[model samples]
Target chain A: MPDYLAGIDIGSTMTKVVIMDNGIISSVMGPTGPEQRRLANKVMEEALRRVNLSFKEITYLVATGYGRINVPFADKQITEITCHAKGAAHFFAEARTIIDIGGQDSKAIKIQDGRPIDFVMNDKCAAGTGRYLEVTADALGIPIEKMGPTALGAKNPAQISNICTVFAEQEVVARLAEGVPLDDLVAGILESLASRISRMVNRLKVEKELVITGGGAKNVGLVTALSEKLGCTARVPPEPLLTGAVGAALLGKDMVGKALKQGLPLEKKERSLREISLY
Target chain B: MAEEQKKEERKKRKTATEAASKIGGMVKAAIGGTVRAKEEGKKLAYSFIVCSYDEIIRAMDIVPVWTENYAGICGAKRDAQRFLERAESLGFSRSLCTYALCGLGFDQWREELGEMPPDAPWGGQARPDMMLSSGQILCDPRNKWYQAAQQFMPDVPIYDVGLPWPMYEDDIEVSEIQDYYIAYIVAELRGLVKFLEEQTGRNMDYDRLSDLVDLGEKTWNLIWETYELRRSVPTPMGTGDAMNTMVPMVFMLGTQEGYDFFAELNRELKEKIAKGEGVVPDEKYRLLWGGGLPSWFALTDFNYFNSKGAVFPVETTYRMIEPTYRLNIPDTDDPIERLAWRWLGYWTYWFDKAKKRPGSEPDVERLIQYIEDYQIDGVVMHEAFSCRTWHLGLIWQLNQLKKIYKPIPVLVLGAGDKKSLEHRELPSLILESDIVDISSYSEVDTRARIDAFIETLESTKKSKADQQ
Candidate 1:
């Protein structure tokens, strides 16, 4: 039987699963909900169904991201930081730096020879993450997806000086009250967020080719602003949101391969793809 | 729901080491002793730790109420919230040093109530006859904390002693300024002695002070030796226990108890090393707690690292004792002069070596030396939100250290292979929180960061092994 491996990433705002059999078989992404365990199971079940397989067919599994421990059936858990580095490296072999701005946190990881050498994360704040843009977008009555495109169309981007997300939202409203263009407001928001993330990324001595991953990377305007700030054009994977999950799956395969090479028993759960019963 | 369940399933943290466990009783007695000092006719004085005046106070038979240690006890016991709230209400910003705020808040409450605050940790910090405000070069709060406390108790006098050292300069030898700095410190000590004599209505005892100073030097040397044992692989003790052991070294410095405790601790670590015992059963990665004061309330964070197969063999916090014999001080019978010399020596101990090291300052040099000596795989630090004195330089130090290369001997292969050396950069992690502010802490976030750091360490280890 061909060996199968799976990776699940339960981020603060999104849940993703990627299934692999030597190469990628299927991948799924969805918004995370309060019921993390159910969401994890449901996401995994969907990804498995897409590949016509059940949990038992997986040779090994790994979970990553903020809510990784919530996936009760995962064979092992790794951090999203490591998963992102590996996944970015997989997509871009020469990738040396990764800037991942997720739902609630942003991090810059420095890579050497496809391995994470160092990283720095923003302090406990939401000013430099996807949450910042989401809050600003809601305040401006613009969809999070539209903010990026709207930002790219700006004739004159307003200078946003507020470092706090709440204050930045207030600033956006104040600018709108003064009849500032919506595109300019959106551009200003992305610029401020990019600057914050760039400052953190610079701490690692950022080198090219920098790959921007995570849901935040899906924002073209923010990615461009960050690349300009970093003085290096950044690359975004085909599916930025799926990189962490893909990396986790690849690491799971590596673990299984190592276990077999050493003739060591692999630790895994007698599994199910169904949601765990509360009772 | 499953995350909460996993958190619940986590094993209870292990207890402190044997020597460390004894700190609780010692601390209780020391605090209780201050409360009873008036009844026993011993004058009680408020003092800060590491101010280098413990011997003088002891010789004068003045009982010291260690305000910072009391604040730390309040933090450890989770009883600091009430005091913190009181201070915040009194116009103290929450962003100020929490230790100072906690101490100030306790003093304000006590002065108002004319008694101890409700449920004060360890019978409350006793009211002092006088306050010694440390006007040190670092810790601006130290110079202000006692003076601010004096607002409530106007009758009590305050003594501000400046404990400045020759600030680090690569070109200037410490010997050039040692005489001037020592003279200034000696004058400060003499002024403190005069102030104490006036308060107690007794003349200064030079002979007794000399003996106490000698004892303090002995205790300092003993502490340096005791902590040196932690350099052993799979260290028998770690920073977690050192936090406990630091109480005696910092607070009880001129006393026999302090020296004896370290003597016992030294013996304990030696025995553990003999049997090849370590802090954890399987020590995977040895880490250095590179900088910053720890979150006193959440010391279990250390245990959390231990559970992940990481052990902190050494930390650049609280372990303040350095070898005193390294400095050349003109032999002086005057205890005050010797005390001043010792103080200057301790601050400048790493200057010469730091100057020789490329891209290194004193703090960074100490970190590099400890990493090499302890065989550290990575560096971990806590950045207390309020204490910028220690937290500010950490980022720059790590950045500078990364820029400098440390040659690691590697064995090459396939071309008449021989062992060659390669320069490599060390990995580091910075945890953010406050020394006593539990509100700023998040166990989930901290653990996630730790997990990520461990992964990075694992990857680096694998890369190194592959290269070899």
Candidate 2:
């Protein structure tokens, strides 16, 4: 029998789920929706099915991300900032700065001794987030998945003034009318968005071993831009988007052990690989 | 060529006719004024005075003059710095909103308008038998400003009209607001009229009151048009111009001339809107700005944001509270309670009802709805030095919005006065500054940092797409 653990990230746009058994990643990715409770159930069901584990067998289930509050099954909820730091620390133990650009917001967190010392988060506007890229892609009639490489291919990127997603759309439309190259426009968008991220990280006093995570980390163009802008090498974790969820699951396991040590009663089920409590 | 000249002549004639009509209305208001009443030839029955709203000023048989109009007589603009110093010496810190202190300092100087520079037109001598203040509480506590009035004029009656907070939407809050505002306005109006009767030795006139309400309604309609013009993308006026445009309302809130000027301005704005021409062209981004007044020391940061294709569609807390002025009118004899409620009811002024029980969540929801309705691209939350309310709940709202609208980006920037920028430990605050501290980062270094952030966002966008 093996021990089982689960991690869930309830993002603004999507939810991600991961299952790990004795330190080996067993399953990744799950469909999530706007409603938190519904998405939590869906992700949990999927993770349980993939591992062939029943709900009673799961030793710990942890939740993180914007919708962490709505996860009823999770034994504990940690701030996304804290979770990201822990997850990044696990991957790159010496990482000093963690820059996580998610669907709706961008955060630059300062890490010291595996603890999140300070952080800056953008939540009020949509200009520099994933939505900006999605809207720009939609307006360009390009699938969002193709934007980064296409942008990288362009030699001359047009200058886009507005970083605001809505206003940027109008500018993109106008530029298209003016016959600007799509590659250039995409590069310009990337360049403009990078400036906002730089501001967030710069506030924390940029340090070495910068690790980038979240859904946005997968873009090579942005990585190149950030590296160039910061004048320092940056690293992205494997399965960058799952970092927060992984941290959440790990934290949950720690919480369960601590609770048991403190003489708190555990759920009546035995700790086994086949019958885990998905919650 | 002769037909063209004739057409031009006809247009000039039409303009002249309109101007004459406007002048005639002013003349009528100037003549239909009332004298203040007195006891024992000088008992000073009214304790403090506030200028009336255009509607109330017209409703009363008195003239309405905004405090800004007395600046020249008080030499406020020229001596504004001096006056501010005096206020600071008296314990008003520079951190207090400059606008409120300036208004108060100017009012104090107006008390001695007769001794002003000869070039001063009005001499600050138009002593009001009564005064009224609208419920705009963006800066200092309105009640404190009211309290300060006694130092300038020991005996004039001061009345405040209650302005509700989170304007333009009817909710459960309005009934309490209406009751509070109505009581103050009615009491103040009655007190003002009673004083006038004692001085002039004549009873109040019902007919006169009816005439004033009609004038007030017209003025309000004119101001509404001014606000409507701003809805146009790129706006019909620049930020500087918008500040200036507020002058007519502040000075002549209760006058026919004020109404006519705004009406004409509205007409001009409508023409521009119809032509599809922005007041300021080449707008790239429509942004929603949240924060109190920007640091005066760092005013250029706002322009920096704007120059980057970001146009501020709505300012949080300050101007959003302005529209509450329309809710209650002084229809009763008791105007004091109405005056108090109108000024005190502003959301940010006193106990923010939004933060109790149901708390600020609903307010956040409304703000989000407003952003969506306005089609705003992003939110730029300026976490200022001392504003705790906005700074505290910002993260929660950002996370919530991110969960629902994952596409929009929320940027949080921290800024403060000159002193805060000097501290090395305040990296969170310093990094947020657009113009980095010179000692900490060179000009080149700052530019590099800003450029880097922009690159990060671009790269993030790129990487996400590649994965998909």
Candidate 3:
């Protein structure tokens, strides 16, 4: 039987899973809810079913992201920063910088030879994260998906000087009351978020070519604003949300390969792909 | 949900060395000693550390209430919140140094009740007869904290002494400004002596002062020799233990106990090194705690690093004792003159070397030197939000280090149409939190950042091994 490797990423806002056999056989993602254990199990089962594989057939599994410790059926766990660098480099091998804007926090990782050498992350604040956009979008009474397209039509973006999300919402509402266009307001918010993220990414000196990943990369407006702020074009993966899961699966594949080469037995958990009721 | 998110109690750290566990008792006794000194009609003076006045105070038979040490004790005990809130209520902004604010709050409450604050750490800091605030180049809080506290006790007089040094200049030689710096520091030390004489009605005992200064210098040399042993491959001790060891080095400067403690620690470390012991059982990475003051509440963060196979053999903070043998000083019979010379010598020891290197300051140069000497794999710095004295300019130092030390090569366009290699810096992590304010810290977020940093270190190591 071939080595069937699996990777699961239980992020703060989303859960993803990928199964690999030389290449990706299947991948699945969904919103992360209050119950992480249940959601991780559900996502992993869906990915395995797509590839017609059972839990016992999987050679090794690696879990990653914020809720990585919640996954009980994994051989080992690694941080999302490492996994994202690996997954992003898999797509763009020449990329030296990786900007990941996730739900709770954002980070900039410097990649060297397909491995992360250094990284800088946002402090304990939600001002420069996807959650900030979600909060502002909710206040604007606009769908999060439509905020991007709405921003693309702006003639002159409104100015938002507040760094606090609550104060920024007040600025948005005050600007709306003054008859500013909705498109301008949305565009201004995304631009402001882009500036915050670019400042953090600049700490790593911003080497080319850069790849933007995570749930936030799905927004074309943010990608445009960030690229303009960085003064370089950024490449986004085909499925931005799946890079972490893909990276996890890739790392698991390497573990299996290394063990096989060294003639050593791989250490793995005795996992049954069933829902754990601990949580 | 908010209640669950708020964790007031911190994780208890596991110390690697036996000497570190005894620091708590040392702190408690020191605090209690001041209170007993007051009851016995002995004069008490409020003093700050690194002021270079501990030996002089001991010579004058005056008890020093180390206000900063008490503030740190309050922070480590997790009882500083109420005092901090009191300071805020008195119109002190939270943006100011929390150590100063905590002491000022306790002073006001003590004056109002004419006793210790309720449930104060170690029976609260004793009320002082006078305040000795040092006007130094670093730490504006040292000059202002006691004066602010003195407002609550109008009877206590404040003595402000200027202990300025000539700022480093490329063109200026140490000899050009050494005399002036020493003259100013000597005058400051004599003025401090006069202030103590007037307060306590004691005559200047030159012989005792000279002997005390001698002990202080001997202790300083012992400290340097002991800590330098951390260069051992496994690093028998780490900075987590140094946080405890610093108590004697800073607080008990002229006393024989301070010198004896280092002698004992030196023996313990040597024994451990001989037996092939380390702070971590399997020390994979040796890190430098390069800059900024530590989070007094979350010192267990060091243990957290230890759990990940990272051991900090050397740190720039609180390890203020440098080798005296490396200095060139004029022979002086006066104890005060020697004290002044040593002060200037310690601060400017790295000046000549720092000036020789391009894009390198004294702090950065010291970091690079320690990195080479200790075989450090990565650098970790804490940025205490309230302390601009130590925390400011750290980023610039790190940037300069990266610009100068290019170890990792990446391709760049050369003079012709060919690609050449340009190097980058070693991996680093900066943890942001306040020194005393627990409310500003989140253990979960800090741990996540640490986890990411360790992953970077691992990948960097793997790539290096691959290249070799």
Candidate 1: Cα lDDT at A104: 85
Residue B455 C-alpha lDDT in model 1? 90
lDDT values, one for every candidate = 0.86, 0.55, 0.87
* Residue pairs with backbone atoms closer than 3 Å in model 3 (clashes): none
Residue A119, model 3: Cα distance from true site in angstroms = 0.8
lDDT of 3 at B279: 97
True contacts kept of each: 0.73, 0.04, 0.77
Give the CAPRI rating of model 2. incorrect
- Which segments of model 3 are wrong by more than 4 Å? A36-38, A274-279, B1-11, B407-425
Q: Using lDDT, give the best candidate's number.
A: 3
DockQ of 3: 0.67
Compare candidates 2 and 3 on lDDT and give the better one: 3
Q: Candidate 1, after superposition: displacement of residue B336 in Å?
A: 0.7
Candidate 3 A-chain TM-score: 0.96
User: Per-residue lDDT tens digits of candidate 2, residues A192-233?
Assistant: 787778976775667888999987788777777787788788
Task: Report the lDDT of model 3 for residue B273.
Answer: 93
Tens digits of lDDT, candidate 2, B1-468: 557634533332111112223432342242222112221232222211223434343444344444433322232123335455556676766555343454455456557563332332323324445545544434233445545656777776665544434443333455555555545556655665665565546666655554544454455556655665566776544332333344445545545666777777777767767877653367654545543333322333434544444455554533422333544444544333333444444343322333442434555664565465544545555444333334555556555444444322333335552222111111111123211111112332222222222223322334335444
Can you write out model 3's per-residue Cα lDDT over B352-443, one digit (the tens) per residue?
88888865677778898998899888888888888988788788887877765554766766688799664434788899998888899998
What DockQ results do all the predictions give, each relative to the true complex? 0.66, 0.03, 0.67
Q: Is candidate 1 or candidate 2 better by TM-score?
A: 1
